[model samples]
Target: MGRRPVHVVGRVIVGLLALALTGCAAPAAPADSALSLGSTAAAAPVALTASATAAARTAKIYSIRTTDATKGVITVIGTLSPAPKTGTRIPLHQWIPSARRWQEVAHGYSSGTSVTIKTVQPGSVRTYRIAVGPQAPYAAAISPMISFKHYVWRGIFKKGLLATGGNATPQFNIVPPKEGPRRAEADLLADKGGYVWGEVNSTGCSFVRNWLGNLTDGTVRTSLHNGRRR
Candidate 1:
């Protein structure tokens, strides 16, 4: 039996080579399906309350509610119903005036029925909408903008000591303003004081940026004010 002095090393090398070739011949795994349960298509417009007409035209309305500021519990309820459809998911989004962007807040399947969102921010106006089809939709509600008023000092002072011919330093002081009674109109007119200070601080920057921010903030305040009235 020992006569051949079997070439065990050669056999082991061949076996390893065969195993390596086998691994190389194996097929790759398949990719996952593109369709996801939570995914949806662009949403269609739905009727909104009279107070939300302006926002509804430009932004979709999803849901609205009043809540206790301290406990975060819902006190008022509002809901939106989309047209009947199958395999459709609707997402609620809010317009962020500061960022000038729409952000998704919540999402769920629209079973041709109304889903209520509860425990929302008190005195806070919000928007929601639905997305249908295979592609994700931009469904959203544009809550009427809320108005917030704060005071700002509109004075200037010297920056450095009396001896140095220091440049004038602009200063501002923010103070809370009184709330006005809700108006009947969908768009509420509210006065805000802090924007002027923001503009003053952004003096050296692009005028457009400062202007846009102030403008958007003002618009949001007006929207919120109107939304609350409804």
Candidate 2:
């Protein structure tokens, strides 16, 4: 009757209070669980860092000049400031007549602030440039392009070439350097851009051919009328 209703109401109130107590007691895990995940660990902020400065940079190069000497040799002279670091090598580039671009040929370390570079004189008139490579804070710099050419050995084919033949047509030939991706006759022509280190002379008695065979030791031998002539 009336007691039963009151008892039921009392039980309902106790259940509601127990539910509120459990809700407050339990801790939230969504935020904390997310932070503990492996993916979140990778996004952590980096720690701050600091240190002191080091010696001031002091590297510079100036003025490049090339001179042609006897026996196909060229001397390159230049100056550097603050002395170069040991193992610092300077680069020399030569212009490719066909490609119309520059390519590095040789490199060497400097001798104190003044640099003396010796290179085989170019076989033909060519252009050269000195490049100072970039070092950390410094940017790369290049020297004024210098042109080098040897005085043409003057002669009117004085000991000239005359083709010889019996009852047939004569033959003439021109040879070029051996090593390259492609062989070209551009250097063998007799035009303004050509070079000659030897000439041919022939008469009806027989056929005589003279040509320059560059030896490994920088000395050239000429095959004359009879045999090998220096």
Candidate 3:
């Protein structure tokens, strides 16, 4: 081939060099797009953590009450708002007058949102509440305080004919079924000349007891039997 012009050769060489440089130097991604990608990746874990914390904070304790006052028994209940991923532990707190602070008395674990805990009867009156410890997506919570006392049954007496000889009927202060038939002590009074008979009902007893009394010439006679005595 005939020798090419210097200018033409120079132009071809420059064009080839320009093409190579363009291929080697690829276009860079937009600054905004690159920065946005990095930011999204970095915030993913934080967003998840915040969501978990919020879910845990929403959990709460709602209600607690005395189920069996006479037995010193109590029931504690609560709701887990959105519910937790796993079971949660519940603890019972009692106010100690001597200590002047709350003390943990009992604890239990639950799997569902609705929880119920029953406590064994205590020896004395006590103020109590229920608490739930942190369970990841379920936060810690506490219930309202409740007080319980041993139940007592009193007698209601009806007397007829005050002098000479008379009859008296007695009713007991009892919440049927719950309190049921119980053992009790009562003071019987017989003035002048008359007969007194009454039934006593109380807690911690399975059977009922009745008493009968007779008075004459300023003397009193007492007896106890399944049926009325004369």
> Where does candidate 3 have its weakest 10-residue lDDT segment?
154-163
Error of 2 at 117 (Å): 1.5
Residue-wise C-alpha lDDT for candidate 3, range 149-211, written one tens digit per residue: 633232212122122223543222323443433223334554445455544323343344355
Candidate 1 deviant stretches above 4 angstroms: 1-63, 67-69, 73-87, 119-230
TM-score of 1: 0.26
Instruction: Report, for every candidate in turn, its global Cα lDDT versus the true structure.
Output: 0.35, 0.51, 0.57
* Per-residue accuracy of model 1 over 1-230 as CA lDDT, tens digit each: 66344777678889999999878765332222223322322122233333354432122334344344333344222233333344344555555667877776555554443444343332334443333333223234433332322122221111111221112342332222222111111111234432212212222211111111223433432111111222
Residues 1-230, candidate 2: write the lDDT tens digits: 98999999999999999999888765655666676675755444322111112222333334333354323455666555545655568877888889999988766677776566667653467887766666644455566677765432212232443433222232333323354212112222232322333334322222322334442344433334442355
Error of 3 at 210 (Å): 11
Q: What is the lDDT of candidate 1?
A: 0.35
**What does the lDDT read for residue 104 in candidate 1?**
64
Pitting candidate 1 against candidate 2, the one with the higher TM-score is 2
Candidate 1, run of 10 with poorest lDDT: 180-189
